[model samples]
Target: MEKSHLESALPIANERNKASSRHVRQKLAWALIPLTLTYLTFSKHSPHMSAFHRPAINYTAQCIQPSALFPKDTPELSKAFDFISTPTFVNASIERLSGAVKIKTETFDDLGEIGVDQRWDVFYAFHEYLEKTFPLVHEKLKVEKVNTHGLLYTWQGSDATLKPTTLMAHQDTVPVPAETIPAWDYPPWSGFYDGKYIWGRGSSDCKNQLIATLETVSLLLSANFSPRRTILLAYGFDEETFGYHGAGNLSALIHSRYGDDGLAVIVDEGASFEEAWGTVFAKPGAAEKGSTNVEITIRSPGGHSSIPRDHTSIGILSELIYLIESTQYPTRLYDENPYFTQLQCGAAYSPEFDPKLKTLLDRRLHSGSDETSTCMAKHDPLALEAAKKGPEIKYLLQTSQAVDIISGGAKVNALPERAQAIVNHRINVGETAQVVFDHLTRVAAHVATKHNLTLHAFDGIEEPSSLILTHNEVLDPAPVTPSSPHPQTPFSILAGTNRAIYGSEIITTPGIMTGNTDTRFFWDLTKHIFRFAPGYDDSEGKEGMGNIHTVNERVSVVNHVNAVKWFMLFLRNLDEADL
Candidate 1:
């Protein structure tokens, strides 16, 4: 799918949130290595548990430590903030972000291979821009460019025994549609600041995050703070697209160096805090649904339109599309889905959650037995129905299908020789790309049988008067990051940092990125991957991010500053930990 289509799907995706692979423990020990062998492999060929084989939900797990964990205050942290709080530093930070945004590092799905495509040249300019804007970063960090454009920066720690902490943000922005330019409040590339928000195409989706990490690192450098553990900053240039040229290559490099589970933790741009039922919830993406594009083509005899058959190739294609859409994937709420944890978190913590629903949720999640069957015997239907209340929640559980692109006849008088439509599917947790492919094959088979046409799918041959099904960009669902309830684990460290910065009122919970991110490539680097942007948003997708990927895309100055502070504190907290 194109980045624009992915962005258009965000309203449904961003509405909620992973399916995880291994259960995370508070501490890693040699004895546990054998147990985690399945998770450590990080390959689609590895054993994957279908939803049927998934273990029962242990509803009794703590969502977050009863109270937020706080890192001890240090002089370096105080000094870091002292500089960060200054009006001069704030202005400079804003300008640094604006300057980066003004570069127009837009990437599209159709971009050709690097070196051949002149468009890839823009990232070279972006690299130079980074050098000029943050000279301290360039001078101090060990910098290497992967596959020509992926940026990897390493801050060498005094000690190498501890795994490095990795932070990620993409450097590319979705291209602003030429037609949508008139709808934008400011030129998409202007990086306009109206004393409140930084406005641009990349402002909210990623540039805000990229600049904030730099600002944090630069400030840490100013404090002359030497880390006990190494720090890695990975910026991919093509996250807005399929990310093969960027993150895919970067991950291969990182994997070669770090081996499996080498990093202490990985933090990437994802969901920020969202408010619901008067209680604020900070959702960190711990899992992601898989995605693939299925293309269906129908071939038939072409003649004058006047002599067309009862149904033309285009008509057959339309029938297939309708059948796929009409037979929507079943919505199932398994205990293992990350969104289930979010629902449990709301029920456990939200003061204003629907009382009756809370009661039902409690009965479902906290049933006496650890087995899901016991709970499903009674409360499953009610809980599933409650979860379907909104599209945001619905898509989190359902494997989504949308017929995105279609094409057919070219001439008014001639019958079309071929018709094609691309159906996009975000595979639900506990499902594989094969599952979606099989579903498409079944649908096509039925349609072909009804129309007396030859059928072609994964195992079929193409012929005239045939219906063909093929897939591309097949991505199995990501391995779920192992989230922990203990205070000392990586998940808890992130939750603690959010509480330390945003305050104790916020309830941190595990969330799935309904839409995937660059972390999809870094699955082997760490089991503790966290997709969180530390900014506050009380009204979903509004306060922290303003219309991301569409017109008027912007990020608030307050959220930007807060993100800088959060990154600073998060590094300190991670550095002090024993994970």
Candidate 2:
């Protein structure tokens, strides 16, 4: 108490010092207020703003300086650009049909023999439409009918020395289940054009490719643009029905006439450069993954509902699910993967991560944590992070499969003794169907034995072929070409369109493909095959894109025009290359 009183009496000078200290702190906070506001504004606005719009534009300008970015022009590059820009007769002919023929889906009664009669009607209608609409082109093109399913059009090239190039597309489309979709804005078969798109089933799928090839041929005929190589357009009618009678027979015919080595390049449809990925890299499919359709079944003795066995068929099926989830395929790098390295280069183009990326490219650093942390700091972080995580990330980057379909149970009260499940696997590149099946068998056996259950396997052992990229050296005979095989050019993956009929090859690229196409039949013919489409990247679910094989399917008018342009550029670029 005495000390407190003494301090209170002597605190006038101390009180003044304390007041000065508080005033200084307030002034310091006022000074920092503007800085804090500036930082908050910048953090919020930077991402949405383009580099050109930033307050500190000099940073972006300096980072993307002309010297550091792609060069303006060189003799070779100029040549390439000139070739890409040149107007071909093919381009002009497509412009003519750009407004003419209307392709629509053909409908049929859902009653008796719907499948057979509808397929026949669709085929005949297609043939009739070709005859009526493309009479002139049809007259010039040699058409060969194969059984009830396949059609081939041959346009002899001007250059007898060069091997022929075959452009392939399927005529048939997958049948729509009548119950799934109730109605369409334009009836599926109407082939309606709303001044901006072609509304129908096959517009983007194979019909687009079919029309483009025919248009190219028509233009060449009109302009007398004789190619040094031959051109053949092959259309398969039964492509939707596994291509057994369409592409299968045509491939056999090709093998008989040309042998394996005589044929130059057979282009079909598969992958396309989507805008989503193109934001990072211009290249689309350098390789596609393999696929296998598998069916698994478990059966037991049926019994009454009241007195059931300890382990019913449903119980056994439940164990199978656990087995599949627990086992996963081993992941590795694709040896023939030109796309991956090209993607890495594209990722390094931005200013912020260039130094760190260069270190990764040089293989001086192998730290995932450092790479991942650096990527998350960028504006476009997903793509960079995916690249840094390496092959495992890429393998699962797209929707690769563990399971798709599962079926079981018959009645409410019955102890069902039989259960089955069908799993469709879109295999990672470099992996085979047999390997996947072996893994499944092992896992299933382990689970079954552990539960004292009997497991019977029936399907899913068939192995589809791996992906392949055509080297310019191998594809020299083809007119369209790429500049180099430096893991960046589009032609690094120009295998024949039909990979399913051909089997796997040394030139193949390892990856996974999420969807199925007619190119599956070509795997029997040659392993040096790949599947891809051009014009637009429809990989990501984007607007202006149609629901493939569903009601109200359509393709944009702009996409159709660009399709013509891309095909022309691809042809000219390849034709001019020395290989």
Best by lDDT: 1
Residue-pair clashes, model 2: 29
**Model 1 Cα displacement at 536 (Å)?**
2.2
Query: Cα RMSD for candidate 1?
Result: 18.9
TM-score of each candidate structure, all chains considered together: 0.86, 0.65
RMSD of each: 18.9, 15.4
Model 1 Cα lDDT, one tens digit per residue, 1-579: 699999998876655421121222323556677777755443212223222333444443546444555556668768778777789988998898888889989998899989999998999888999999999999999999999999999999988889999999999999998999999889999999998888998898898999999988998898887898999999999998978889999889989988998999999999888878778888889888999998899998999999779889999899888899888776666666787777777766777777666545544543443233444443345446666579887888778999999999989989999999988999888678887988888888999999998887965567798898888678888887777755478888888888887788888888888888999889888889889888664433545656888898988877888889888888988888888
What Cα-based lDDT does every candidate model obtain? Answer: 0.82, 0.51
Question: Per-residue lDDT of 1-579 in model 2, one digit per residue for the tens?
Answer: 998988876788788889999999999999999998887666433443222333422222211211111223345444533442355532433343332224433333232242456545556656776667567678887788776546888777666665566678887665656675467677555566676566666776667777766655554455445455666677876665556566777877767776654545556765554222223223334345556655666666676878887777777777777667666454333323343344344443433334443433322122223222343443223334444655445553322445666777788778776666666565554445666666677777776676565544433222211111111111000111221334322244232111111222112222233444455544433433435455553333464345676777777655555555455444444343332
Could you tell me which 10 consecutive residues in candidate 1 have the lowest summed lDDT?
A: 17-26
On a 0 to 100 scale, what is the lDDT of residue 506 in model 1? Answer: 82
Candidate 1 at 355: error in angstroms?
2.9
